[model samples]
Target: MEEVRVKLPFNLAAGETEYRSGVWQGLVLKWQKEHLLLELPAEADSISSAVYGGGMGRLKRAVNQFVSRDYECSNPVRDMEAKLVEWGYPLEGCAGLMTAVPLEHAAVAEEDTGSAGIFCCVTAAAGNAARAGSQRSVLAAYRPGTINIMLAIDGWLSPSAMVNAVMTATEAKAAALADLGISDAENGLPATGTTTDAVVLAVSGSRRYAAEHVYAGTATDLGGAIGRLVYSTVTASLRSVKAAEAERK
Candidate 1:
C-alpha cells in the first residue's frame, strides 16, 4: 500500500542568496517504515554539465549534511548558496516545492514489480535547448538550460526501472514541450529542453518518519503526477519567459 496521508508541499530554502528566485523551494519529510535514504540528480544524466557538476556535487554533500546532521539543516539558505556557488551558477534566489508522494508500489502501467515510496520536487528554466548525444562544444558558455527534477524514493527499485524512470520523465517533458511547440530553431528540439536535461533521483532503504505512512495508490499515480506537474509547471515557466521577452521586444 502507498502512503497517501502526508504533510507536504512544505518549503525548504537556504543560501545567502535565497533559493526563491523562481519556483518555491520545499523540503518534504515523509516519516514512515524501514530506513533512511538520500537522492540527488544523476550527473551527466541531468542538467549537470561539466560546469554544473560542482553544483550537483555540493547538493549531494548538503543533502548528506542535512541528513547525517539529523535530516535538518541549521541554515538551509547558506546550504543552497553553497551548492549553487560550487556549481558556479549561484543566483540571488531559488525555490522548490517539497511534497510527499505515493510510490509504495510499482506503477499500475506495469505489473507489480515491488513496493516503493516517493518524495519529489521540480524547478523549471527553459532558457536553452540542446540535442541528445551532442558534444559539449555545442553547449553555449554561461547559458544554462531549464528544468531540474529532484526525486527521492524509498526502497529498492530494479536498476532498469530506475533508468526507465528518468527516460520516462524526459519523454513526458518532451511531449509537453512538443504540445507547446517549445523547440529550438536549429534542430527543432525544445529550446529549454536539452538531451542532457537533469533528473536527479535517489533510492534507499525505507525509513518511517512517522507512524503508519502508506500511500493509497500505486507508483503509477506518482509517475503521472510527475509528468503532469512537470508539464504544467515547465510550460508555465516557458510562458513567463516568452511573455517577458515579448514585453522587452
Candidate 2:
C-alpha cells in the first residue's frame, strides 16, 4: 500500500533545521545525537511535565529556552543536569524534556492565525505503549521509549487556560494512538500513550494581540488549533518512526 503523506496546516521541519513561527525561532541541533532547542523572543508563561523545571511558572532571567533532548540513561535527572552544564545552559531557567526517540525522527508543525500562532514538536516511540487504567500483575521497570511533546503559542493564555491546553493536547495524543490501532502489550487493549510521555506548553503572553485566551477547551479556537497541531504532529512522528523501521527491515 502506498503511504499517504499527512498534510500539515503549516510547514513540517525535520532533522537539523531552523524554523520560525510567529514570534518564535528555533534550532534543531545534532550534537552527540539530535535534540531541539526553541528560544522564545522573550520570557513566557509556561507549564511542563518535564524532569527539569517541570511546573507552571513564569520563566525568568531571559531563560525562555525550551529543550527536547534525545536521552538514554539510567540516571536521567543527574545526566540531564550534566548535559545542561556541558552545553553551558543554566539548569535554573530552562525547561527540558528527554526521550529515547532520536531527534532525527522528530516532527514539527506550525500554524499562524494572524491573531495567534501555535507551534508543536514531537518525538514519539511506542515500544512500551499501554492503555491507561489497564490491569497489570506487575509494574514494568522504566524503559527508554517515550512520547515527548513541546508546544508554544505566540499569544496570551490565562493560567487556567494553560492547564486546559495540556488536557486538550493529551486527549489528542490518545486519539492519535487509537487511530493508529496501537494496542497495549500487557492487556491487548487500545493504547492511549506511552507511560513515560511528557509535554511542555509555553505561551508568549504578548499583548500585541487583542485577544487573551481564558479557555482552551476543544470548543475554543485556541484549543482547536492545539488539538489539530498536536494530533497531526504525533501521528506524523509515529508514522515516520514506523517507516524508518520498515526501511531497516
Candidate 3:
C-alpha cells in the first residue's frame, strides 16, 4: 500500500509553518522533523501537564515561548532539554509537550468573541487509547501514541479559572473520542483519552477586558467556547488520521 500524506486545514511553509490569531503567533519548526512553537504577545499565565515544564507558573522574566514537539525517545526530559538548547530556546521560559504524532497531522481551531478570543491546536494519535480508570497499574514508560493540546486565550483569568479551563477542555476531549466511537483497545470501553495525553492552557492575563473570569464551567461562556473549540479540533485531528489510514488500505 502506498503511503498517503494527511492534509492540514492550513498550509505549511517549506522551513517553518506559521499561524497567527488575534492573541498569539505560532510556528511549526522543522528540525529533524517538525514541532510547534507559540510566541505570545506578552508573558502569560499558563498551566500544563507537559514533560519539560509541567505545572502552574507565570511565563515571566523572558519566559514566553510554548512548544509542542514530536518525540519518540526514551529520555523525553533530557532529550527535550537538549532540543531546546539546540533550537536556541531557553528552558527557563518555555513550556513543552511531547507526542509521537507527526506535526503535519495537527489541527487548529480558533474562536473570537468580542470580549475574548481563543485559539486551540491539537496533535493526536490514539493507538493506545484507554479509559482513565479501566487500565491496571504498571511501571511508567514513554508511550508513543498520545494526544497533545495547546490552548491560548486573549483574556484575563484567575488562577482558579485556569484550572477550571483545563477541566473543561479535558471533558471536551473525552466527549470527542466518545462521539467518534473510539474505544479503548485494552478494555473495549469508550476511550476517555490516551495513556499519555497532555494539555496546556495559557491566558493573556490582560486587564483590557472588562470581565475577569473567575469561573470556567460548561455553564459559563468561556467554558462553553473552550469545550466547543477543543471538541472540534480533536475530532478534526483524529478524522484526518483515520482518513490517511483509509487511503493506505
Candidate 4:
C-alpha cells in the first residue's frame, strides 16, 4: 500500500491519483490499494458559516484556517468549529460536515476495486420536517432543515445511478436519526416516516475510472463509509445542540 502525505488548505494546482473520486470541500479521496485515504484538515470536524453569500470563497478560508493556518489540533469535535472561527465572523448554522477514512487501509475488501469507490462528505440538520402521511402545502411557507450529502465516485455513473446513490444515502440518513430516537424532536412523525431534505454532490471521474461505473452494495468502500459517516456526523451535530439545550436548563 502506497501512503501519500498531504498538506491541507493549500492551493491545489492539480489532483491526486490515489483517489478514484472528485474533490468535495477541498478534500479528495485516495485509495491505498486496499483502504481509503482522504486529504483533509485534521482539525476539520464540523464546518459552519454565516456568510451565506460568498460561501464558496469563504468556505476555503474557513477550511484553510483549521487545516492550514491554525497549528492547534487539540480541540474536541463537540465545539471545534466555533472555537476555530476567527473573531468577527458570523456564526450561523453549522454545516455538520464529516468525512470517513478507515484507519487501516489494509482491511479494505479485495472485491472493492476499479471505479467502485467514492470520496464524500455530508452535512445534516433536521430542524424542519413534514409528516409522512400528510400532504404538503407549497402555499404554506415553512423553513426547511439542512440535510445534505456529497459523493465523488470513481466512474461516470448514469443519471439513474446517481439518483440511486442519493436515495440510498437518504434512507441511510433517516435510519441514522431514527436510531437516536431523537426523543427531543418535534418534527412531524417518528421512525418509518419523517425524513429531512438533502443535497448530493459529486464530480467527474477520471478516464480510467470512467471505464466502469457500477454501484453495488454500499457496505464497503465508499457507500458503507458514507452511510456510517453521515449518520455519525448528523448524530454528533444533534448531540451538540441537544447538549447545549440541557445546559441552558
Best candidate, lDDT-wise?
3
Mind sharing the TM-score for model 1?
A: 0.46
Per-residue lDDT for 3-87 in model 1, tens only?
2221122222321211211111132222122111222332111212222232222233112111121223344445545654564
Model 2: ten consecutive residues of lowest lDDT: 1-10
Instruction: Name the lDDT value of residue 181 in candidate 1.
Output: 70
lDDT-based ranking, best first?
Answer: 3, 2, 1, 4
Q: Global lDDT for candidate 1? A: 0.38
The TM-score of candidate 3 is 0.85
Candidate 4 RMSD to the real structure: 12.9
Candidate 2 lDDT, tens digit per residue, 147-209? 888888888888999999999999999999999999998899999998778888878787777
Instruction: Report the CA-based lDDT of candidate 3 relative to the real structure.
Output: 0.72
**Span of ten consecutive residues with least summed lDDT in model 3:** 60-69
- What candidate 4 gets wrong by more than 4 Å, as runs, is 1-117, 134-139, 142-144, 183-188, 191-196, 208-211, 216-222
Model 2 local distance difference test score: 0.71
In order of appearance, the predictions have TM-scores of: 0.46, 0.83, 0.85, 0.46
Which of 2 and 3 is ahead in lDDT?
A: 3
Of the pair 1 and 2, which is ahead by TM-score?
2
For candidate 4, give the lDDT: 0.38
lDDT of each: 0.38, 0.71, 0.72, 0.38
